[model samples]
Target: MSRHLNAGERIIESETLSGGITAEMRKLTIWTTDGFSRNLVLRTYTDSASLQHAEDSLERESTALTTLSGSAVPVPELLAFDSTATHCEYPSILMTHVPGSTVLADEGVDDRVPLLARQLVEIHAVKAEPRPREYQAMTTADTVVVPTRADAEVWAAAIDVLRGPVPTYDGRVLHRDFLPGNVLFDVSQNAAPSITGVVDWAGASWGPTDLDVAHCSTNLALLHGPQWGPRFASAYEEAGGVLSESTRTRQYWRVRDALACSEEVQSWAAPWREAGRVDLTPGVVEDRLDAYISMLMNASGQ
Candidate 1:
């Protein structure tokens, strides 16, 4: 609705809907020189208070892209960036569309499960700068050092332990969100495609190699169920991955994910509450919530 937008660039057609973080992701039918031929997905964020932080994330992504430039990885090409404004009123980025049939079968992630593990191993195989840690406001180092002993808080606790020992460990390149959905399987490459692009650089950070694997493995199980769980780990081990070293780190993320799910229940709360959007049973939420809690308990050696 802002008048100061780029000239003659009225949105041909657009739709607003929930995106990855409860924010609106808009699909724009734009007027291109060749005609309205492009379908672009634009995700926006609010909280002007964190504009600077958003820009930093944008910059961090830029660095990751640059690091991944000459590799086999597939990622959306960064098109436009304006990290300084609020959603619909601030900075944004335009990316090339990544189109392909999802590898996820109706039953869930298929047995070609090892593909994910292979990619993770391959990503770490990439040589790049040390990964930066995400501390919400005051980011930390990637080298993890568990000091005197581990704490009970899980993810944050691991960071505390690692901070005392080695805040930043020079490790393999980590795709912070290297999940199956984040992965694009190439059907065009005669079995495996020549390129597999990983999207969503929001949480891309450098750290332990196994952290990436465990994040994907545990999350897949959490999202899809136990069937795909062991296969993921199986594929990971087959791909030269080490489970022992990062299991603790992986546990941290598993617990962190549960906390994330809990927060979402509160998101869109006021509107949903007024709209009677609490259709999902409370027990269902608790069941899913408990999965993460169980994972945390197991990781704590409790």
Candidate 2:
């Protein structure tokens, strides 16, 4: 349609769509004079501004993508990153438009399932000494998100669990947002999405591979629910993953992480609560807590 230039150098056009509340994913088709069609996506961060630390988020995203470029992950090449934290420029990251339908929204993506597992595993295999302290140093990424924050033990235990010497992840990049939307596929081609490439390395970190899996699990659950989560976990384990007790802790990390962002949960769920609707926000935190507790219990059992 109409071409508009965002920033000074890039001339881009984006349109909004219905469905999902995280950010606005605009269908961006970049223009080239040579009749070359390049379709890229631009995500304008629209998380509830009241609860959002926009500047910090953009900083994380920029760093994570930069690190991801050198890691094992297959991320879309970065086109531009502008973190206008103070200038109020709406921190944005313009990414290379990789071509693939979403595994969560679109159907007929069964075959590419294995590669999803493979990609996570391969990307996680990269090692970094002394894992970074927090994921935000990573990226405004898609870490396994839990929509609540009303827990205490989860926070303490996560520190205890991850306190050990960071596993050697080969310094490869972690795709903090290794979910379906960030993933591109060639479902039309028999070869699965080909993974074509990955998007949102903003939260890429030097942590256990399980962090990647848990992140995938949590995000996929938001879109596809439990069915997708377990299926993805199973596929990951089946594909020759070098599983260990430590890696399993990533699930606990996910719980702790989700708890940390409880405010967001309160935001999305607050409306329902004010209207005297059955409050699910408490349950959201509870579910995450139970998962964390279960992880602890299982470890004791072992």
Candidate 3:
């Protein structure tokens, strides 16, 4: 901590940041020699389980921040990282804080949806030399957790989509977890709401752009409504982001990502529940997921 701090600068405060499930996040306020305060965010993987992959996760995030440093994307500046936990209590990363709060309320999603779409376009457009690791699937057909009351036929169809071989795609940089919770927004009386920064790059990868879009779409479906899932895809196209030429191929990615969420729906809802969305019970999320899959299949004429 002392090495990362400027001469005569000292920590004045530390506050825990919520809405993250994987890592413990803290905001550190530093009082500098110039008599002003600045903030840095610390992300530490402290759990016994998380420790198993902490080094890899921290390495990915640090490399991502380094890769996107001069790009149009609004990302926090990486200050320091201890991927091995040798210099810190746990594997950690310290980065300059981006100003904004996550907006999870459903009322203004329509306004932010396009901005989210455009930001994703910018993110996917970045080129990385010796690209990040290939994206990995989080769920397989056998691993999918079907909702207790889900339409068996619909779920079977959705799961079947994943049983097929992974689709081939031109690789692009991916914010593998590009959901609303990872996006920061600034909403003020004086101006329109806008995205301020995107955080959580530990899952960054190189993959089909649709995978990133699918991840965010599934999250939007659970957070807002099933309609928002497909709505985001349309918004992405309007914002100049391209999807696969075949509807079947596009549906495969969408269904695959949506099913991945089913397996961890309960755990995923925990952070949103903590953030004041008590209405998003596990049961509700499961139902929304079912609806989103049905909608996808219907649109694809499956």
Candidate 4:
């Protein structure tokens, strides 16, 4: 595999990374004949009809990485991608390994929030052509099976507000899954950590800047408590991240995002648990969703 990646080189070490649900990721260390070495990440997706969403995500991620090379956005450089899974076990993408860790350290939220806010602003600032598919939040309407009354009521109210035409935003690049997990930072003993890379671009697409902002806000509220949601928005606005002043505009995105919280909570729980967050559970997620919905309602003056 190392020779395939770089001529005359061999893999010295390989380690699988943790906390990925959609794809399998591994870090490969390869040394050249003269002993020079480099690290790269190999990501592969299994072939499953049920996992089409994950496969599509990898495709978009590959496209985004290739598209954003040499751009200001801090993304991993794409080395190679194979859709046929000929080289590896499954369809794979090889990229330069980024040097940093996620913001899971017991660091002060105050210290980290501003850096997170500003970097997100930079991501939305990047330019991209609009993709044919528009971003859609997972509403209860998307479900085919019968839903409980409680779930029906929750989604019914959301559907009422979201029934109108899908609001549009200036076509900006969106990291659809923007959150603490996807953000990597380089931390030193003496200084503050700075963002090194924004990863997991499988969810990348074209949308309004605020859509990403709202998604991050939901994640902040869910993971940290509702208080952090407003703080994140304030920091973003203070750092000049574009957000609509109109409460209506903001809630349009927020409500759509908040309604999807249940699924996000379920999807993210396994990874969070693997990362040592045993406190995460479906009920906790529900409570967080309730708080977030209240926050959005208040923000929109509804």
Candidate 5:
């Protein structure tokens, strides 16, 4: 691995990262014969199923990193990408590792919420040509289906309320899956936490900025509380990101995300159950989804 990036250097150690649903991450520590050392993240699929099912290919993510170079969005530097599996069991992208920890359910995270809001502002500020068709189907609420009796009636009504033309807005390159789990924070003793980088660009696309906003805000509500969503949205607007106060517009996105993410939340049940998070049950997720939908509707003045 070191030879691919640094000549005369060899990997001294490597560690695999867990908690990733799509791809496996490995931090490779490399040392040169002259004593220089550095760390790089080798991101690749663990199996053919993951490789094929991923939202974006390593090549696509590499292209995105290249395109985002010098942009306000904090992203890892793409060192190299190999589409063919000749060099490894699966295709991969090697990138400079951004030093930080993924903050999930941390007690000290409240102080850092504003910082995360600002980072999203920076991301939305980047200029890019519109890719309207990109991710339209995934973010569109019209296609949602209720899987069982647990979600049938409410899910059907949520879909009904969401029926309309997709709201048009100024297009920006979006971090489609932006959430606390995907953001890395550099935290130290008695120091302000700063976001080092936002990873997991697999779902990235050019689309309405509010999709990103709604996605993060909704996730914040689920992880924190109902109040966090409004707080985060307010913080985002205060940081120079334009978010419409129109309840209908807000509802459009919240509903879109609710429909799209419910499936994801349900899919996570197995993994959470395996990890012993007994609370991540179908009932819990359904309740959360229903609450989130209702929150959006009430906020939308329904």
Candidate 6:
């Protein structure tokens, strides 16, 4: 911390920031020689499993921040990183604090959806040279967790979709985890709401744009409603973002990502519950996922 600080600057305060499940996030307030304070975000992988299993996560985030600097995407500026924990107690990356807060409330979602869609379009437009690692699937058909009350036939069909070969796609820069939680919004009273920044770049990758869309759509379904899942896909298209040409191919990706969240809906709801969305219990999320899967199947003419 001292090495990155400007001369005569000292840390004035530190506070934990929420919405991070895999890492510890801290906002460091620094008092500079000019008698003003600035903020920086420190993300630390304190969990032993993260350090042991995903050893290159911090390195990937650092590289991503470096790559996206000055691009249209609003991402934090990387200040420093210690991927091996040689200089810090845990593997950490320090970055300039991006302004705004995550908007998880159910109210005003209709207004915010299009902005989220547009910003994601801008993110995919970026051409990453020496791109980040290729995207990896988080769940397989065998690994999918079927909800107890889910329609057994529908769930079976969804799982079978994943068992088929992956569809062909043109690679694009992907914000591999571009869900609402990772997006920050500026919603001032007098002005329209807009996306201020997108954080959590550790999962950034080079992949099909549909994969990124699927991830966010699945999250929207769980966080808001089943209608919102398909609504977001429509919003994305209206925002000038193109999806896979075939409806079946799009359904395959959407079903795959939706099923991936089945096992972790309860864990995912914990943070949102803490953030004041107590209505989003695990059961509610599961029901939404089931509805979302059924919608995709029907849309694909199953």
| Winning candidate number (lDDT) | 3
lDDT of 1 by residue, 1-302 (tens): 33423456566788663224423457676665545456565655565554556776666666776777678776666656656664447555555556653444323356447667777777777776555554231224243322223332544543443344322334567777676556666666445443356776766676665456656754565455534444576687788875544444455444443344343433312332333334423443344344445555554511
Q: Can you tell me which runs of candidate 2 are displaced by over 4 Å? A: 1-13, 17-22, 35-37, 46-52, 70-72, 85-88, 105-110, 126-133, 136-172, 189-191, 220-231, 246-251, 254-302
User: Against the true structure, what is each candidate's TM-score?
Assistant: 0.64, 0.61, 0.97, 0.87, 0.86, 0.97
Q: Which parts of model 1 have CA positions greater than 4 angstroms off?
A: 1-11, 47-52, 86-88, 101-108, 129-170, 184-196, 242-282, 285-302
TM-score, candidate 6, is 0.97
Tens-digit per-residue lDDT, 70-168, candidate 5: 887788998877766667777777888888877655377578778888999888776654342265446445556455533456566668766787777
Please identify model 6 stretches exceeding 4 Å from their true place.
Answer: none
lDDT digits (tens) for residues 55-152 of candidate 2: 45555566655555666666666666556633334556666666554454424435656788888877766654444335442212234243244244
RMSD of 1: 7.6
The positional error of residue 155 in candidate 3, measured at the CA in angstroms, is 0.9
Using TM-score as the measure, what is the rank order of every candidate, best first? 3, 6, 4, 5, 1, 2
Q: Backbone clashes per model, in order?
A: 10, 18, 0, 0, 0, 0
Cα RMSD for predicted model 4? 3.1
Stronger candidate by lDDT (3 vs 6): 3
True-vs-predicted CA distance for residue 241, candidate 2, Å: 3.7
Candidate 5, superposed: residue stretches over 4 Å from native: 53-55, 84-87, 129-133, 139-153, 266-283
> Candidate 5 — which pairs collide?
none
Model 3 lDDT tens row, 166-230: 87898999999998999999888878998889999999899999889999999999999998888
Better of 5 and 6 by lDDT: 6
RMSD of 3: 1.2
| Backbone clash total, candidate 2 | 18
Task: Give the per-residue lDDT of model 6 (tens digit) for 1-302.
Answer: 99999999999999999878889999999998988999999999887667773457877788889999999999999999998889988889999999999999998999989999999999999978898888889899889898999999989988999999999999888889999999999989988898889999998888888899899998998888888888898899899998988888888889889999987878888999999999988788888888998988878822
For candidate 4, lDDT tens digit of each residue in 1-302? 54356578888899999877778889999887787898999887864742567556667888888778888888999888776666667778888999998865334667888998998888877766545245556564353222222355444555455665666567677888888888888888888879899888877887777778878878777777777777888888888888776767777777777666655567775676677766766677567667666656655622
**What is the full ranking by lDDT, best candidate first?**
3, 6, 4, 5, 1, 2
Q: Return whichever of 2 and 6 wins on TM-score.
A: 6
